[model samples]
Target: MKKLKIGLLINPVAGLGGSVALKGSDGENIQQQAIQLGATPQAEEKALRALQHVVDYKNKVEFYTVSGQMGEHICQKLQFSHSIVHTTSGKTSASDTEHAINEFENIDLDIIVFAGGDGTARNVTKALNKDIPVLGIPAGCKIHSGVYSVTPSAAGKLLQKLLTGEMLSVSYADVMDIDESSFRQGIVKTKRYGELPVPMDLTYIQAVKQGGIEHDELVLADICADILENMEDDTLYLIGSGATTKSLMDELQLDSTLLGIDAVYQENLIGKDLTALQIEELVADYPKTKLIVSPIGGQGHLFGRGNQQLSAKTLAAIGKNNTIVVSTKSKLKALQGRPLIIDVLDQNVAKSYKGLIKITTGYHDSVLYSITD
Candidate 1:
């Protein structure tokens, strides 16, 4: 049987700052700060999950990867047939990613699967010399790009389809990246770096994130009023990141972290820019807590994009029953008919929240919506 040649690249520190509420893990300083705040690197574990789906086809596939944490580690851990195409020492950077891809160009491969966010996608675009198909394992704090699969397991399933010789369409996906410095300050500045050839499958690949703020002031005020009027005494409110949720904090006249999660009690600010662990601890103190979340404008993701502070465990502690889904009518209209996506990287947890859900669109108006994995 002819073996499938696959290229793999892993960014070890891709999402080190997410659970720590650092916004992103782009620079060396930010990564260190995340570590100080108890953020653990999960990119390698996510890569392992993606590779696990293809392990059954070990005899039918060969992998080309870089040494150390970039790719070789996962390949070796899984005992898959693989070749190290490049070597790196210490911590890896965008330069290493570029050089690794340069080496990948020398070998013929079916597809290049990389684990990171939009930054790694930019590096791949910078170094790629051929139009080979590429796919992303969403392991970064920022995933505004369209090249990534919805989740790690989804990426593995896509690879499994390729191994089984399933007919899949190949197309181009935009490689988009945002200015992390500006993102930290609550400003979303996104740019289209380039494009990559990717397999077309909505079930796996995600759409580019929609950036910008809504201009409907009246509707926002109504939503905020409804939330405040219904506020229960002594209950903790976890205000999630996003412009819609920010409006609620603004109505309370409290300090709001534009792009970070905050805690509120009786319309008073309690915690600003909280981490997952911090949120879990705080949830334990409150007898009643509600998590207010809004979906990504274009992608319709409720849990995964730019809100890693709400880890799987945190979501469990909050419980879906105590959750509030807020969105503007226009944002829902933009989805046309697609269901809201929940990609917390835990399939079982994501599945538990699937099905019809209620979304608060205005002060007295809410509609039943569908949630999907």
Candidate 2:
């Protein structure tokens, strides 16, 4: 059997701003500030998770990657047979990512697996231009792009399948991203930069994010009524990001972060756009708390897609029973019978909430939904 050639790339700074509430780490200033805010590099850890799945197949594959944090470090750590095709500075940039891809163009690679978010996807698409198939490990904060796998381990599984010829055929997936400036200000402005050739298996790869539907105003009103009626005094409520949840905040006449987490107490917006640390601090002051979250449209993700602010520690503290999920019937229908996905970065945490859970659809209206990782 001929060994399959695979190219690896990692954006070391990718997703560094997620926990600290910076929205993204696109620029040097933002990356530095995120580190100063106590945010750590997550892309390397996420990349290692994906690569671990393919470790047993090392003898059947040859890996090519850039030097240092871009790729070589993890390859060596995992003892994978890899060669450093390009050298990168200790500090990496988008130009380094593009240059690495340009170098890979001379090699005959079966696939190029990258660990990063939408920005990394855009850079890869620009360099390769669909010249080869690519896959993404979800390591960024705002993953509105379709290029990423549903989870890090799933990326490894998909790569294994592709290399063994178990999966075939490729489809164009949208590479989308949001403006960080507007995103940090509670505004969501996404643009489709380009598309990349991804595997056709829908079970492994995520679909492009869908825009908010014009749900019936009355339904939203009913949901708000139910939430307000159930509000408990002296207890904190962590509001997750989404259009549906924002409507609930709007009904209460309280300020809300459209694409960021917020804290509420007695129906008052106490904290707008909070980080994980900020949430922990508030949770300490108000020991009793409930989390209000909504699913991502088309993707069916209840957590870890765009709401990293609700870290595993926060969720564990909030408890699953204390969590309330709200979504319009139309949104659930669009899921096409798929279970709500969870990628909280900790498998044990994601597995804690299995089986059916209730989703608050309207006033005194709820539906049982299955939760999965």
Cα lDDT listed for each candidate: 0.89, 0.87
Please write out the lDDT profile of model 2 over residues 214-254, one tens digit for every residue: 56899988988999899999789999788888898898889
Tens digits of per-residue lDDT, candidate 1, 244-348, equal 999998888999998899999977888999999889999988888889999988778888777999988878777778889999999999887778888776767
Candidate 2, poorest ten consecutive residues by summed lDDT: 207-216
Best by lDDT: 1
Candidate 1 has what TM-score?
0.95
Each prediction's TM-score versus the true structure: 0.95, 0.96
Q: In candidate 1, which residue ranges exceed 4 Å CA deviation? A: 346-348
- Worst ten in a row by lDDT for model 1: 343-352
101 Cα displacement, candidate 1 (Å):
0.5
Candidate 2 global Cα RMSD: 1.5
lDDT, model 1, position 181: 89
lDDT, model 2, position 148: 92
